[model samples]
Target: MIAKEFTNYIFKNNIIRFGEFRLKSGRLSPYFFNFGAFNSASKLSSLGEFYASTIIEKKIDFDVIFGPAYKGIPIALSTALSLNKKDYPDVPFSFNRKEIKQYGEGGQIIGSKIKGKRVLAVDDVLTSGKTIRNTKEIIESEGGILYAFLVALDREEKGLNTELSALEEAARECNVKIYSVANISNIIEYLNENYDKNHKFNKSVREYIEIHGSKK
Candidate 1:
């Protein structure tokens, strides 16, 4: 999708917001994004297309995509399906189980061959990055080669220190890059381009970025 279309799609659907809210990471956020609200196949299909566009834009290279348990499962499936529709049918997708199922697949991972394949982990948001880190460990234990991770948003806030967030740490530890469809900076830029009081939120986001977004 084009930039205009992508931005309108997200904004029109209320995927992004500005307000006081408690985040899952326990930080007070001025905005919140919930792509999980996309419930229909059509919405999911379109969202996946955007995700594919972002991945292509970043030139992320990976043979397969792995989504962690629960939320990541559908995102990965939809992204894979979108890529498939674009004639990139060779890309395979997989997801993990929250609990080891006693029947059928019998393991934490399901769909496609994960072992030894260079995989890109997909998820909705990169908050603390703990989820992605754990997922990476699981994939590695299964012999999957983690290439990188792609998420819908990057909070751009520090994780463990005023310098780095958990996502960055994960990238450092895994020796891979972390790409996002948009980030705190992007959001601020978007707002600055479209709204009034831009400096206020921009400064706020920057403060968070400086305080919690780097690894020092």
Candidate 2:
């Protein structure tokens, strides 16, 4: 159970909160995952270990790890470091700049070159899959193939079309495998079995999922 452990870790750290929150899609959600809560060094290292473990467990093959600009930068770096320490050495990581550098090594990408490489994009969560699509475009534009995507959690909610979950849609549309360390289903199961079953937040989360969860 790495997934269970991760679920507990996120709950203990308050990285995943149960309450009313508005999403970018303008939907009211009962639960929210704040990846930015991993602010401390130890927390970030643990987060990286979770991602690295998932990548290793899944046997994902890639030449480089690419994190999208901003939030994904540290995730990519940390995962690479954790992998190296866990004996998956020399896994190069790269990230894009929000603004292209006009001088010197002038490009949007920083760190390892992605040209002709197989890239694994790392991010926090899968909501609408817009971020994943954008990252795929960036990798393709730079002559790299996006091998797969890894995220901390998969919301498992309906996509824009209200048919498939965002994760499922992203994988199908991008033609790449997408993996998560844990997902909303895992969280629900963990709460029902390990946490207080009578908790109001637990009830609320379960109800919300019943309404919003994807069909498959």
Candidate 3:
């Protein structure tokens, strides 16, 4: 379900934009995953189900599902909702605010509290991982233990001054495990097999990977 529907949604909605695009890391990337593309309720429901299934399949043992501020908020919430529908039901979910509320119910983390609990951090992608690293720190400060991080996809590009991709390096740095639904290599293989040899999209993707891919 995730394989076909997810891919179809991405391509159909042009969420997977391809071209010479500049990443936040200042490296030129051939493709970018725009999570903002999941604009509809149906799209988010599909995404929520995908995330839920991935967590269940990976068997990520944890107590809390934490999402970082802004973009990560919905993913964490929706995932919790989806998980509630499945075997792992009523999982506590949480997210941080970029700016803490100054009044009434003032706090950073919302939804599930993260004290003396093992957390599974969720996000869309692992780019630089600065935000994620900060998220882990916040969790730890709040007395929660973060042992695993999950994302929708992994680009597999090198992190800052490291041979490992952002996802791998983040996992190692935080001493936690990392999981993803798909990676660049997986996407490349899928494109190569599903698309024509002369497809411009796949060609650009291959070229980009050859240039920017992490050695590891």
Per-model TM-score, in order, reads 0.86, 0.96, 0.92
**Rank ordering of all candidates by TM-score, starting from the highest:** 2, 3, 1
RMSD of 2: 1.2
lDDT of 3: 0.82
Alpha-carbon lDDT, every model: 0.77, 0.90, 0.82
Which model, 2 or 3, shows the larger lDDT?
Answer: 2
Clash tally, candidates in order: 10, 0, 0
Better of 1 and 3 by lDDT: 3
Which parts of model 1 are misplaced by more than 4 Å?
A: 1-5, 198-216
RMSD of each: 2.7, 1.2, 1.8
Candidate 3 per-residue C-alpha lDDT over 79-128 given as tens digits, one digit per residue, 9 for 90 to 100? 88889888676788888888878899997788889999999988887778
Instruction: Sort by lDDT, best first.
Output: 2, 3, 1
| Index of the highest-lDDT prediction | 2
Q: For candidate 2, lDDT tens digit of each residue in 10-101? A: 98899998779999878899889988799999999998999999999889899999999888999999999999999886899999998889
Which is superior by TM-score, 1 or 2? 2
In candidate 1, residue 2 scores what lDDT? Answer: 43
lDDT comparing candidate 1 with the true structure: 0.77
Put down candidate 1 lDDT per residue, 81-133, tens digits, no spaces. Answer: 88887777478898887888898758778888888899999888888878777
